[model samples]
Target: MSKHWKKLPWIIAGILVLIGLLNPPLLPWILLILVSAAYWFLPRRGLIGPVTLPADDAFLPSQQVQWWYWTGHLFTDDGRRFGFEVVFFSFDAFVIMRDQLVQAAITDVNGQRFEFEEFLRLHLPKRVKDGFDLSSGAGNQVTAVGGDGHDRLHAQIGNYTLDLKLDSTQQPALHYGGDAHPYRFGGYTYYYSRPKMATTGTLTIDGQTFQVTGNSWFDRQYGELFQAIRQGWQWFAIELEDNRQIMLFDFKGNDSSVEKSGSITDANGLTTTLAAHEFEVTVTGEWTSPNTGCTYPSGWEIVVKGEKFTVEPLVKDQELRANHDLWIGPVYWEGACGVGGAVAGQAYVELNGYCKCLAAKLP
Candidate 1:
């Protein structure tokens, strides 16, 4: 027991003794004191203990804030390409809290899209086993980093199904404080990312199954409370042909100025930290979403070490209008891209909070 807890009984006894000495409603004071002490001392066993890892990398489940995120880009043997995101979010809020939500989506360069989101409340259909796998009844979603440190994922929505196996060639990239220091991002989450994972699996779209092989990204963030409303971020992940992975995040302030940071993990699993002012991101063009009229940065010209790179989307309309509570709870654009210039690679870009604090803009 903590020192504070050890003194609790003495404190309660002292209060009761004082009330009896004063001779003021002894019976009521005794009853109230006993009830309060019992309530305070009662054990509130939880599913998880002290955080063994930050929100992004966990060895055990969290009772507070948690989410399992997986996103990837794959190509068929015939050069047809696709992208997908399977995520499960769980957190508790004093109010305005939905227990959990499973969001899954798949997109193709040919303009085919499929998305499934289900809001869960009191009886949210989900299970977190060993803090590594998350299984949800929402569209049969599962995102797990198994003992071998590979991601096994599956999701089905109508005629669209994403079944992929992701093997981590590099160690996890810790973006912020790990378990020892969990004060970042509202003191809730320790964040990390698997910038690139070698992926192979079957993707069924519109009843057509295709064998695909490509790279994907995995991000995990969990904590007691992730108060992201302070502002949002522009997240980028790039995987070079040489197996080098680069990731950058521009955390935006209310006025839109960005705080740039991220990491670069080499092919050999060595990570070089990128601090603020180490890099810059600039938009080369914009795309106005026909669905919500939200203008998003379409083409990007990102610069690092005085070298510039240009990236273009596989499709201009990769915006996910997840207006429902079951999804990201925000309107944002997440898509695969073709990178050129300084690095030849495939990339993924996520743009959020452009219209407001996390997808508040709508038609």
Candidate 2:
């Protein structure tokens, strides 16, 4: 039975019992109220419990396994653009983005068509500081990383669809952090992997196939409240021409106070956390969104401790605004960056919502 459907019987039974106990000849209305309260307040016992995995599971190495994510943005051209993101241990994943009033379709690896239509909406029991708890919308995502060294993915959201295969031969470096000197994000997130994935497949949009050849960055983080409202960040994941990679992020809060920021991983999985002043991020350009009327930092200048590198945008206008909202997310100026003020390698810099101001708080 579906998870949501299973809750219906208990809810109906509670309502019926309350009605019966409220009769005129009953002991009292207060007694009925107390009984109802007991039904609602009793501890949940049975199969429901926190999810757990064995420590030595084979799939434990990949953080992407059995995880769900949401990347939503409101694009002006469409109104609302949302994608359901999921990565499986098998390397199969999918991303589906679409707007209302449209029908989308999903095409699998073999070019098969599947109707992708569904919506899952639920209200929050409490309000959030930045935004309402809102609902976790409806979507479908499936991925599998095969033992033969290949990744497959399929996703469906509204009328959009995304299916592709990623080459797994190019393994990513792994890194681990502990609470003593944990990742700057605050929570315990198993961070690892390559900064880029060479993708070779087709990305179909509304029945049209666009040949795709691009690099994708994959990150998996699971923890409670990894970031606070006061903390603004600037992040960069650069792929160098020398086949090396650089990943860094800095968190800054009020009074220009540096909370915590640094490069957590290097090319070969060796880890290091740079001091606040060891790295710097300077915005070189800005772009304003016509939809949300919000301006985003479009260009940047990055200096990494003793290492020297520069990054620029390939497509600065890569703005996604759908569902009558605006999300000026980073698409980036990525390419081979000169490292150590001499060597060159692939580089990409991301200036998040903080581009509006140093102390800008996100909504």
Candidate 3:
């Protein structure tokens, strides 16, 4: 694991891009898929030196494609409960164009789904203040105050508008990495999460509005998006009733070998980094989408650190087609889930990469 060897993928990609100048159509695409496989199969051997992290509010260099992600559970005043996710991705480095996207989805307990996504390529400016403050300078916006642990989420599209405030209750952040340095998969991200938070807001659908309040989870991942991850990933963010939280992500690959990483944040906010071999995830049920005929896992039995849990979706039809083909492509399953077995809790489950062999998020 030398630094020189780690630079090989970019070198190859740059060479392909240069060659693509003459062979426009074919080589560029070949390069795209090649770079993607690098992230999918490449073996990451930790880091050279420890990188201090949980750097909440910390950002990557503007040149790298990066994003801020948040997700949570909500309970409406009338007793309707649902799950939601808000994600921002700046794809400047990947496309050679100043492209950015904001995507949000809500999945209700009764199997109903609503999705909203905004992609802006030519616009004013993507502004950041006090570290985490983000302004899209458009009708759709998300802003996070660095110290307040407060985030304002809003969007206006067609006849629907959503506005919510998230107040994080977990502190110091959950840093997923080595003893001192942050762990980065695909070699470009410094990742962390506020596993438990309080959320309140108003969501307007058509002409009606609903007031909601509940618990949530916030994940902040920033850095190189074009680092290349070939197959998509299956992820889970689970919150137990005992003030404990767990986040697990496994990058799916073709050979049936998946790269696993996760962390458990206890009531005191201390995090325990999980080794890949320390857990096992088994798919217990499958559902085939009539739209694409792509089958996705519907039930899971996860054994982590010797504890077992069963996860089942609150609704079977909770799928979202953000259709972000220019960057991360494919239709994915993201919805609220119920957790049983060793723990009784609520969770958000995501199933991606099931639609095709070559789909990924650059970082």
TM-score of each: 0.75, 0.54, 0.74
Error of 1 at 140 (Å): 1.9
Q: How accurate is candidate 3 locally (lDDT)?
A: 0.67
Q: At residue 361, give the lDDT of candidate 2.
A: 20
Candidate 3: residue 124 lDDT (0-100): 19
Worst window of 10 by summed lDDT in candidate 3: 43-52
Q: Which ten residues in a row have the lowest lDDT in candidate 1?
A: 53-62
Candidate 1 deviant stretches above 4 angstroms: 1-64, 94-98, 111-130, 138-148, 177-188, 254-258, 323-328, 356-363
Write out the backbone clash pairs for model 3.
51-181, 225-362, 225-363
Per-residue lDDT, model 1, residue 61, is 29
Better of 2 and 3 by lDDT: 3
What's each prediction's clash count? 5, 30, 3
RMSD of 2: 11.3
Give per-residue lDDT, candidate 2, residue 66.
Answer: 19
Per-candidate Cα lDDT values, in order, are 0.67, 0.40, 0.67
lDDT score at residue 149, model 2, on the 0-100 scale: 27
| Residue lDDT tens for model 1, 1-363 | 555886677686777878777886685768677777656764332334333433224433234566667778888998988878777777655225646666677777765654554434442323333335556654444444452347688877557777888887767777653442233454445566777678999988778899999888887765554545345678888877777778887766644443457777887877777776777888889998776777888888888767688888877877766556443446678887888987788888888676533434344
